[model samples]
Target chain A: MERIKPSLQLKDDIDLHISGWIVQRIGWVLLLLLLIAASLGVFGTGWLSAGHVAGKNGTVSFERIARFETPMKLVVQIEKADGDIEIRIPRSYLDCMEIDKIVPEPATQKAAGGSAIYTFDAEAESTITFYLMPESTGSIHTELTIDNTNFPIAHFIFP
Target chain B: MNPVVRGVAVYLFLLVVFRIMGKRSLSESTTFDFVLLLIISEVTQQALVGQDYSLTGAFILITTLISLDLIFSLIKEKFHLFGKIAEGVPLIVVDQGKPLTKRMRKCKVSEEDILEAARFHFGLEKMEQIRYAILEKDGSISIVPEKEKASIK
Candidate 1:
């Protein structure tokens, strides 16, 4: 038996074409749009806690958003009619988010119900900012208590 | 994020991105292209594991990526049309000592590239000495010398 050698000839059988089908092109366009939107932080969660005033006692406001392994800022403002007021935050929030920095460092801190309560003394009015980073992706919820008033804050972390 | 999921998603994303970029992107590489590739890998690494630096996370991601690649290859083998779509067919850029200028232009393969392949493989200095030049699927060129010239050699 003799082995046959394969022919080495250039044949003009089909026209040269490099592009794919129109549907595939459309898919590529959609994918590009999604990537652009994500880069602009459009998919990430953003929430603002309604301003709560304790009947002239003080005003507390904070904005919350969650991002995976990205630092987040939580700003809290308080206006006290009388003496220094203390703020208590759930410890569970600390577990999910690592405190990277705190503006006007807390006057005192204590552990409560799987949460770290940071106390800040506000003589008249003061604003405290907390820089935090999400350890993982998921829903992280915690309660913000100011002058015995509770505000539940929830953040949805993106992966 | 789950490392396995991240690995699969990254693999698919890269596949589509490269496909959309077209074959020339891989065929032609400059010094800047090399740097861009390194930067892309660095960015992909950050997205793959996020903040998880554990050995288990790395292992899972590696396994997932390899598994996905293997599955894709198997599917390519099973389906001829899919394989052709994924890995383009080889094209002829030269016939009977003549360059197929239209096909060559469409494939982004210049006459110089065919001549270079001819010189490297057959030691034939001129295009007239070559019978056929194939632009292979992997972007390499294949040269077949003219019958008379090959017989003489």
Candidate 2:
């Protein structure tokens, strides 16, 4: 009986493939890091993408990171409402997104002073959710006014 | 950056990803391997063309991919070490009717796989009939029949 020996007289670098394997391991590590970042909301869908803006009268919550043409939500919770909740947002940023719907339809909607204003009938407290799809891919800067309290908002859209 | 940049980035990314996945994965040995390759290409299509739908974008992207491939091929030609690292060398898992267990294990090749290749290619039923079983770089096993090999110089 003869024992088979492994030999490739041509050219075999399998034994000396250490550096290449190390580079491959580094790539795997970097990919793991990227996936972790994505899971944490860096790409768009996780806790990291969720943002909150607490104003004096209420709080505004929205997605900090979003994809172009992807659907998202903007929530406004009115802590104190006198009679009607007047929500105003700059037309510049409003134009950047297509508002598909607004829950509890506003009683009045109009564009004034470069801002679209929505007047909603309210009680002591209520929440308004804006269903939006980002139309453009870039940084979006805008301001929102909910019953005299203002909140400056920003969003980054991935292409 | 130009739309060509999009093509370059996507092509390079896919290259690195596929390389790390190993040569065997891309050999398309099984049905699932073929399906996986299809899914990867489908996913890459969006990033390759992006928002550009014009003829210019198409031409640019096509050229970008082709150019990158040409550059890699050229690099492989100029550097022997890089070529070996990029594409592994062929391995002989069996020598003169004896199965090299260590080499076969290291290459993820099994005894069954070698005999299957032998039967498929040379109609040899046993390991003794296999003079040489070579695992090619493309992940295919090639069998040399002992009857004819013994007569060859």
Candidate 3:
């Protein structure tokens, strides 16, 4: 019968030491620093959740400047807290003559100068957002400057 | 402040700090872990940006961090010994239904914790019911149950 010995490797010992230093000690310390720094500064920007996605029945902000060949599409979403909120989309925002869609039968329209205002009522409790036609035309700015003081517009951009 | 310069300094510091935090912090981090993270950022922020911040200071800090990481990664990749050095090996806490008392104490894990992990993982009431138990490098418990085939059949 031969006796067997379990030989210990020097390289293994060195590797374990380095691993302990990096993964357990230094790595942990650095990570803690990062979480804190990012939460307060630039790194924090990527980690925190944006507020615009939360809550309902709020205003929206959009801005686009028209230039050459491609016309811009104006999409608007207006919301309110009460029972019913009304919106008047000015004809200047879209090319109504070229529009093709399932037009609502009960929708009221009124002529305002050379432009027309399309009137529609939305449920107050839930948010109501609608799309304007021509899909692309001149840049439009719809300011949801409704009377109630509490509801503020939430600004967002799509790129 | 110039947004570009501020952005680069801040970004570089965070890159080093987060890399050091390891994968575990992102995985099962507790409240204490979060606090430690916060403090590190506060310290680094002062160094990376502000009136007292110096170009030489930031350069030294960032360079040291990058060099250490690169060296560690290269060693860990090129050789098994270096890899082990860079990452700790799993410690065996239980073998053949017996607890390794020495290893358990070294890991700061009590017999109760070992038993609990074993019981939860293997549905074992006693340590004897476990064939093997290892404390992994990631601070997780791994278990091999006794005669799993027998129980299945």
What is the DockQ for all candidates, taken in turn?
Answer: 0.23, 0.32, 0.10
lDDT of 2 by residue, A1-159 (tens): 123344435444445444555666787788899999999999886899998999888999999999987799999999888899999988888789999999989999999999999999998889999999898888998889999888989999987
Residue-level lDDT tens digits of model 3 in A112-152: 55444454555544333332223333333433333222222
Model 3 interface CAPRI class? incorrect
Candidate 2's C-alpha runs over 4 A off are A1-9, A16-18, A25-33, A91-125, A134-142, A156-159, B50-56, B95-107, B144-153
Q: Write the per-residue lDDT of candidate 3 for residues B1-153, one digit (tens) a residue.
A: 332345456665565454354433433436876787788779757645444366766676567666667766887788976555334566666766778775565455567767777767766777777776766667667777778532653
List the lowest-lDDT window of 10 residues for candidate 1 chain A. Answer: A45-54
Task: Please provide, for model 2 over B32-122, each residue's C-alpha lDDT reduced to its tens digit, 9 standing for 90 to 100.
Answer: 8999989988888877765678998888888888898898889999997676767766667788788878666545678998888887887
Ranking by lDDT: 2, 1, 3
Model 1 chain B: ten consecutive residues of lowest lDDT: B21-30
Model 1, A1-159: lDDT tens digits are 111123654333342243453435676688889877666555553323222333345444433345678876776677663455556777667777888998989888888766567777666677778787888677777777766767667777777
Interface RMSD (Å), each candidate?
10.3, 6.1, 9.9
Estimate every model's Cα lDDT from 0 to 1. 0.70, 0.81, 0.49
The estimated TM-scores of all candidates read 0.69, 0.76, 0.34
Q: What order do candidates take by TM-score, descending?
A: 2, 1, 3
